[model samples]
Target: MNGSSALTLAGVLVLLTVVAVVIRPRGASTVDFYLAGQRVGVATNAWAICGDYFSAASFLGVAAAVYATGLDGAWYAVGFAAGFVPVLLFVAAPLRRFGEFSIPDFLGRRLGSEKVRLVAVGVVQVVILSYLVPQAVGSGITWELLVGSGLLGLSPYATGILVSTAVVAGLVAFGGMRGTTWTQAVQFLLLLGALVWLAATVVGEGFHYGDAVADLSRAPLENPAPDGGLTSEQNALHPEEPAIFGQPGARYGGLGQFALIVTLALGTAGLPHVMNRYFTSPTGAAARTTTVWVLCLAGIFYSLAVMLGTAAREIVPTAVDDHPWLADLTVDGVLQVPEHALPVLGRIYGGDAGLGVVAAGALIAVMSTIAGLLLAAAASWGHDVYERHINPRATQRQAVLAGRVTTLVTACAAAGLGLALRPETFATATASIVATMVTWAFAIAGSALTPVFLLTIWWRRTTAAAAVAGMATGMLVAVAMFTAGLFAAGGLLREALVTPTLVAAPLAAAVTVLVSLRTTAPADVEKSWLIMHGTAADRHAERLAQLVLDENRRRRAGRRARRARG
Candidate 1:
């Protein structure tokens, strides 16, 4: 990308941050900062969820996975999209109805124990930090490639980390959820539009999708290996045979595929940033309906992602032929940096200008996700730790101040870790470094939080002590297993450790049940059940959602009409 384009993108991001801060509600209360005042319409919230959910992992990693592993890579997108299904079925309405400011708040109130709340706060922080590091990594990667220079004498990577971190932290800390929500919704549209345009450009120009899939399937999936050579690749997918792109065992063998999918599917509900989004909905039913819209948007977005991945695989050699500068980066017609599959594809097709557009999308993906995660972190600290523990007598302004400070701190910490760690890619993951870390976060959340979260809502007998035990068990086991897995010799055991949801989640549920059976149930079991699953409550929520969706549609149509007349 040229300096002019780079500066333009920087200006755009700065303008967005300014707009977010400016639009924040004046004299914003704690509610506005933490939960967007609980008045977000269904459509708007759904868009924001899409923005929040599709981070660097979905934007760059999914395509890179396909670029690296063919059909096996498609599972990342599939698993991500599938996760919302469980959210709709088990978590959304009930959790929203419970109406706590944060996950710790809900668990603490429901189980009637400060212990439960504090324990959950630990798990939530782990999840938030795990998720935050990758966004920082993605930002640094984008800046290094797109801008290609350090800013203000910092290393390119550090500059990228600090610049994106500071901007997003400011947006969330100052603007809060109300500001972040609108900004996120707009960012999602920008990301979706960029991907759609890239897909259209590639497929429209005489690229036969069917033929590409057929060819990629017949060729064995291979990745570059370091053997002191320019081009030496080992089979990373389906090593025994030349794998088909659309078939199974192409990327993951044994039970690794199933474990990865289960982790992703269950993890969505456990994600603090994601679940917190439901709390922004105007009502329980609106939250539920917003989930439905999330599913629809996810499906559309992932399908396009799948196409882009396939297109990149088929286009790489041609791209190299068009741009000889990639000779050093592309070995045997495959990009060594799998994460570059999308932006490099853009660089191949449209020169520097094309690269700027796609790279901008990647940067936007990173920052938007950072904004959501920081807000969730703020809620975790400001609401769960500060208001509930440190300063029970604090006023609304004080709470917002706490949240804002926490946001800035979290951003700085995450950025520091991102630069310091710079985790190398795992051999068997067949995903980007950013994406692999995200999977670990998902596994931890799904294992540690989802099981307890669901049982707390669906099972009346769930006790505070049991919920606490289950979460602690899940957190320790998942973290221990993943850390061990990182150093273990590769095989089924390594895969299991890498994606521990299958084992961790069930163990947590079992512990919860056994403890609950031994202990007394939550005192408000009957009332909690009524709040979680009452028929009248569902009806009331659905009616309110219909009104919001109807109004949103009318306003959207009015804007379209006004644009057409102009």
Candidate 2:
């Protein structure tokens, strides 16, 4: 590694360590450890959620997709940003109002069924693992590109996976949700700052966005082929046509595009890590406000990402003559690993320092996301499973220990999977495999958990039996369709299978409705409804807080009067 680049990365890691240590949770209370005492502010939680949500996929893969596929790639950003709308309107407030450590905990208590809670735990783990592995893979990719060196006799990619997972796991295990939230918020600022700096640099260099798109569209799109050369790609939407960079069919057909959007848009509500952030809000209203802030922030971040991707596509080719090192990373002006688009652009503009900034941002993206996922996993396994089921009378200290252990184990598993599914294995298949991998998680979440989760909150008649049925059906259907998609040749069928949320979510909801009609609702359905939708608890909490503040003020005034008399 270059000394400057190494120093930049080490500096970022050290800063995160300091933050985690400084604000680390002190109590043995699981509430403090897992949910940060449910006192996080709207804007801070919004930033932390963005940090958790905008993983390597958002940081690296979105730009990679845009760089490789052009217009279709932009849809990823649009879909991701739009996904929060449903959450804001339907899920956010009620979810926070319900107030639980995890999705499984909420479902179990809401439905009054241990079976529902246990089953939900299984599904949550699946979603978390699905999300976690891609983050690990992203870390590996970033390390390979940024450092270009191995550690402990491993490949740079594998070393990246292990090191990142280990560090983030340690942070979550010790720091808990409070520390993770603070660090995530900071990490997101770094990510946004890096993007802004890169965008400004590119724009300053006399690059016009419209002219670049028009120029790129004038020629056929080509990418690095697996066989070490460039190849012209045909449009998947219209098989007879050559793909154009500015058009819609570079990577996905019309149906594929719609499927991708639907999957991501619906999936946001069901992501355990993201959903868990809602629980950290002090009130349901704060949760809703956080969603609004998240939407606005996401729009800005993604718009810049799309622009930077375009800049990379337009600028990288011209720089190859002057920067010979880039030639090895690219083939005939196109990146072999599409995820390298941003970092490569950074190098071209600011040399090693620019690349360091961008690379550090990528790693930050991976680690922050990993921290969220690990915490989610801990909540599910430790609080939901171990505390509730395995050891019902477990002490607060025991529960916290359980969570830490779960975090470490889950992180290790994700790292191992990342190494197995290394990027080079399918280097030429898609421009940004990380984004596609994340979409699979979206499909699973949208199909399984989201359908049942929404029905539980809105439909008073939604029974525990129906929830189990809906969740089981959604998970199985999504997994089966994705498995079939792996072998199918390209077309609408493949698109539907791979991005199965459009089919699976509706089917899951339908099953839930049908099953609920035949089953008895929970006996406390009305009570649960009041808890979920009523504002009484929020009002009470506000009054209690005001009383405490007034009391403190009176005590201060009395002390001042006594001092004046003396």
Candidate 3:
């Protein structure tokens, strides 16, 4: 391990801990613990959401994908950014208007069924766990590369999984939503700064993006073979042609591309952690406004990630001449693992210090996302399950304790799963393993939740029974297809199986519609609709806040006048 890099990583973690402790909640109130008292401003919530949303997948996997697969890999960024657009248009305002601690809470209340709530809780857990494990794996990968040292006799990768999970879980347990919010916002800024610094350094080093792409396209893409050597990649889409670095057929083909995009695009609305953040907005309008800022910021962030990925592809090969250390990480001129693209680029550009910055950003990315996921899990278990079912009359303190306990348990489970995966064995399994794993979470979310979520928000006749059927069907179908994808041949069939959102989402929607048509609508449908879609509540809240501000200003003025007269 490099001392400078280790020091930088330690410093970043220390800063995060300080922020969490300083901003931790002061009360045992569930509102404060779960939703930050619903007072988060638009700008702050936007940044927190970006922090939560831009996981290791966005920071490491997106760049890695681009470096490995060229243009086709860029679809990850496009699909990710586009996912928020639907949230801006359909989910943001209405979700906050009908506010609750978690997605299960909202759906349970909306459908007026204990059964629906339980089913939603289960689905949310599945989505959260799927998303959480990949983040833990990403932490392990980053740690193995960054520090290369282990504690307690564990491997470097295992140590990272346990340490990051434990640290972030403890922070979430103590800090709750309020603390998590501020820290996430700050962490996002650090992440963005690191990316910007890396990009600037690359460009300053005389790396022209257009020239790089053109030059790479002239030669076939190569990667590390199974025996730890270089081999030319054959185009999956057009086997007759060489897999070029600037072309489309390197990673995905026609069907695979469409399926992957659909999975990511529809997944954002159903991500329990991301959707949970919306509940922190003071008003539905604020939630909508926050989404606008998120889109702008995400665009800038992903564009930089793509550029850096290209920079790594072009610069790293030539860099081996100067940095002999890189010879082990690369086969010939090609990187063995795509996930190393950004971190390697940082080291190339700024030496050990640069690597530390990029590595810290990556760890922060994993931790921030893990924090959000844990909170979401806590809300699902403590609020939706325990408070609503096991102990209806529980006190505020009891509820908060339950949430904390749930956070720890969930974190442990994710860490355990990460350790089981043993990423080192599959280091050559895919170009961007983190991205691939995250896509599974997206596929599940899109298939099982997104369709039903949209229908419940927009369709007044949606019933609890319909929701249960939709979620169960969507989830089962998607998981089954994903399992089938494991042994399926590599082609359009595997693409459809692996990324089944294209099929599963529509099937879920159709089932929901059919079941709803056959069943009677909920008795309080009109009331729920008004709560979800009307603007009167938002207007009244804004007016009350304005009056409070004005009253405080008047009191201040009067006090100043009296002091001057005295």
Candidate 4:
């Protein structure tokens, strides 16, 4: 990249840092650090949720998947975005009304069981770590591809991982949730803008997305199927297939795979980082509004991404030897490094400067996501572990310090994992692995915690023992499935065992309900339901809004009075 381009990228990062520092919450209190004092507005919270939800997976991974696999790659986008719809309808509002600092905290209070809280903390930590490692790997990979040189004798991959991780850790440590929220919201908008701009430029080049797709479809798919149909592999590996559709694989399949889609779509409500965002909103109404905005924005972003992927398919010939830069990167012209396709496309259209902007956007996406995950990790550890178990008498400042320390430790661990597991390339492989690891976490949360949470707020017969039993069974089943998948050889057995949530979640819920039926409901169940479902929090949020307005009016009146006196 040119020095001017490098400078532009550096300037953007510095500006973001400064803005975050300026808005950093002004207290060391756990509430302020963890939840931004619960004062974020709906629109801002929505953007931050986007930032948190759309990680390296959404930015580089989804685009790369589309670039490599064609229409098959679009499945990732569909699965990811569709997951949010369930979250908005079934999870968001009540989660916000629960008003807990973290998922574990919410479960602990509602179920009235510290054991359940600990179990939740353990599950959440595992999910966060699983999700964090891939993001670090992505940053390293992008850095190596974007800038040929590594900083300070470090490999470009290592440098990328270190720098990006450190920057995010510092952001979280200094700004806490308040600063992180504003920065994330802005960052997501920039990401969306980058996507929109790229899409417009690609279209302006006289490339019609629909036309391109039709052309691609007319070509023979490369891979041979069980029934002699084409597969993605055939299309990607064999260039002999007509260049229109590029390659052919399963465009659509039986209901079994459809079940996987259903699992993912319903699973979004269970993700830790996503659920954590709901608590940051001031009220249930704000949370609902935020989800609505997220749905619209996410839908737009994913649609454009799918279109861009199609354009790349049409514009960039499959033969790597045909392109100058691509020849150097991929031996066979098929993108071995799936992440490189989007950046390469950026350069092809906008030259070196455009590549720099796109590369920088990828970095920002990783950084924003890492910051959110680290904070979530810190909250789970510090609040759920140190304060709740180790030192019930710990002060708020002490708890905040613990959380910050945990954030640093978690970041380091993720960086180390990324370095050690330097995979040859990241494609759907990385994404699938990350998704699989968290799938169980979501299942457990949805089946066990979510049920208890809902029932506590709606039904009057949810007991503490039942919640504990439900969470334990959910955790056990999720772990068993994960272990079986990891240890078992590839085949139908593995696929069935690997996605345990499809089995475990329902069983967990069943156990919880069955157990609860035999026990007496907690006396506080009705009162808790009133708090969780009633509009007290919404009313409080409205009152807070009025106070802000009134304060602004008084300030204006005081200024006028001063002017008259003068």
Q: Give the per-residue lDDT digits (tens) of candidate 4, residues 1-566.
A: 33367436635754774586576556778888989899889988989999888777777777765665566567768877888787777678877876899888887887677986887787777778867887887788778877766898899889989988998898787778888888898788877777787888888888887788778777543322333333444322233434224333322223324534555665566667778888988888889889999999889988887787777666766534454776565533445565776677777777766777677777878888888999999899999999999989999888988988999999999999888756453232332333333344444555445555455555667776777777677667866775776677544555556555567667777877898899876666644566577687665776687799999999999999999999
Model 3 TM-score, 2 decimals: 0.94
**Ten contiguous residues minimizing lDDT sum, candidate 2:** 1-10
Stretches of model 1 off by over 4 angstroms after superposition: 1-3, 6-10, 17-21, 24-27, 228-239, 242-246, 423-429, 537-566
What TM-score, to 2 decimals, does candidate 1 have? 0.91
- Tell me the lDDT of model 3 at 415: 96
Q: Candidates' TM-scores?
A: 0.91, 0.94, 0.94, 0.84
Report the lDDT tens digits of candidate 2 across residue range 1-566: 44466547646754764475466555579998999999999988999999999999999989999998999899899889999999999999999988999999999999999999999999999999999998999988888888888898999999899988998999899889998998899889888988999999999999889999999999999887777788888898889999999999887888889999999999999999999999999988899999999999999999999999999999989999998998788888778888999988888888888888898889989999999999999999999999988999999999999999999999988988888997877676666889989988999999999999999999999999999999999999999999899788878888888889989999999999999999999998876787788788665775687799999999999999999999
Q: Write the per-residue lDDT of candidate 3 for residues 452-515, one digit (tens) a residue.
A: 9999999999999999999999999999998898678677888789899999999999999999
Clashing pairs in 3: none
Model 4 TM-score, 2 decimals: 0.84
> Clash pairs of candidate 2?
none
What is candidate 2's local distance difference test score? Answer: 0.90
Candidate 1: C-alpha lDDT: 0.83
